[model samples]
Target: MSERIPVFKPYIGVDTAKAAVDALDLGWLGMGSYVRDFEARLGSVLGVEGERVVAVNTGTSALHLAMLSLGIGPGDEVITPSFNNIGDFQAIRQAGAEPVFCDIDEETLGIDVEKAEALISPRTKALIGMDYAGIPCRLDALQEMAARHQLKVIHDAAHALGSRLHGRSMAAYGDITIFSFDPVKIITSIDGGALVVETATQVEALHRYRLLGMDQSARRMYTNERAWTYDVADRGFRYHLANLHASIGLSQLELLSAFIETRRDACRRYAALLAGVEGLRLPATDFTDVAPFIYYVRIAGGRRDDVIRSLSEAGIDTGIHWIPGHNFTLLKTCRRGDLSVTERVGREILTMPLHSFMPAST
Candidate 1:
């Protein structure tokens, strides 16, 4: 049998394994020097200050913390695209806020700023715009609309860590930007996430919220030491990233530029190979300015399932980026704008195998 190709794979190396083992041997285990080092290096990569970044246990936790730190809660409504990941919706609910689904732009697959603005009302406290497959949303437009309504903007850059918009890093634009380093993401920490905020107040709030609302000094913890006494002034969750995960992340971070280049090359190759196929809509972009997380194509005439089956038989795995949030039982009644584009795209989209350092045969 021919080897099966996975739809997603991490680009881990021997160095990455060694880094994790070395961290384990340090015996400090939990959030420590390695985590701090990772955050600093990540911030440097994003061109943000060290003080503006916070590392957490998962991408979901990053979203939850972003919502909480922004003071979004019961009676508040957050506008988000119905085409987004379920994690974005759950994060709003986790903060006791309602999610108002909006449609997506057919081109970028990101939020439609105009449609999202139409969903805003007196109760709207924030807007969550997610980058689709590393394609950035109209963040400038979203920010402008949010500014008019005095609403906060949370950028879900989970798929866009290495992506740049008009030559500026994705992290350089949004009010609060979050990134994921899960096992299958562009980079893996085993599993981890980060948030980049603007102000010192927001930074301090995120630190507190990710550590059980304790007023413990992060500076002290970064050195692998903890203060004996601390105060709890608000509710928080156990979301801090550990040294082991951070160690792996640090190792991955060192090769992020190369990983991005490799993925982009694979995506370009896919585009070249699959171009001109009738009834298929290839990704709109040329894979420049974006660090693609997945290479997906839209199959027309209801042949998506058949294509998946045929690919499976050939030892090639495939995936679906998501099922529309509104289709889920829990989100059925959520207020939403017209989701015509989102619904159609959801049904037709099929993720193809693409990995960093992907073999030419694949």
Candidate 2:
């Protein structure tokens, strides 16, 4: 029997472990200097200012904070792809806004601009576009649509840490964008995320939203201090990233380029190895622009299930990218536009084993 190839895995080593130990040795583990330094490092990678970044405990928290920063709330509607992690929908709902599910582009596996445009109404406040499986959405087109409709754009770039589109950073688009550092994402901070803002104002708002609306808490924490006497101007959450998590993130960020190369090579390898496999269709590769988090293939002719079973027996693991959000019981009654692409993709897309640490032969 061979080793079981996981659908996703984190690349960790002595450096990462040492980072965690170093944080513990500091004797302070909350959202402090390490978190600030992580945000600064991430900002440098994004070619943005450190003040424009807000580190959070989870990618979902980043999404929720981004929405809240934009003042999206009850009676507001946010258009987003139905074929995405449930966290996307939950984030919108968590902001007291309604998620208006939209269809996805079959090629990009992201929100279809045409379908999203058709669903817009007077109540629409924003659009959330996820970079599904680390492939960036047609962001320029989406941005144009948002401008025309007066809607804010939030790029849910949870899987797009090292990805780009047309040589521009994935985080460089949209009004606000968030990246994930979860165990299964492009990089792991042992569970952390960060939101990128376009303006100093949104940065401040996000800083407050993630720290229980405690004004200046983020800035204070950056100096290894706290807001002992502060004002809570608005609603917020205790969603700030901790020093321990940031330590891991810093270690991982240092090795991000190498991780990107490995993942990119793995994706290309999969494309070559599975090129002639029947009933399997791989996405067109654009290594120059995409830093894929998962190498998913579209299985056709009803062989998806059988292929998964065979892979399982062969010590390989597989997963479905998602089930359409509209199909969920809780969201079944929610408003939705044409989900034709979302429905079809949901049935055919299978996430295969593709990770930074994966063996070349895998």
Residue-level lDDT for 316 in candidate 2: 92
Worst 10 residues of 2 by lDDT: 333-342
Residues 141-163, candidate 1, lDDT per residue (tens digit)?
Answer: 99998999899999999999899
Where does candidate 1 have its weakest 10-residue lDDT segment?
331-340
lDDT of 2 at 289: 74
Residues 1-362, model 2: lDDT tens digits: 67788888888899989999999998779999999899999999988888888899999998888888888999999998888889988988888889898888878888899889999999999998888888888899999999998899999989888888888887789998999999888778999889988788888888878888888757678777776688988887899999999999999999888888888888888888889998788887657678788889999888899989998999999999888888888898565657887788888999898888567766
lDDT of 1 at 286: 86
Q: TM-score per candidate, in order?
A: 0.99, 0.97
Q: Which parts of model 1 have CA positions greater than 4 angstroms off?
A: none
How does model 2 fare in lDDT? 0.87
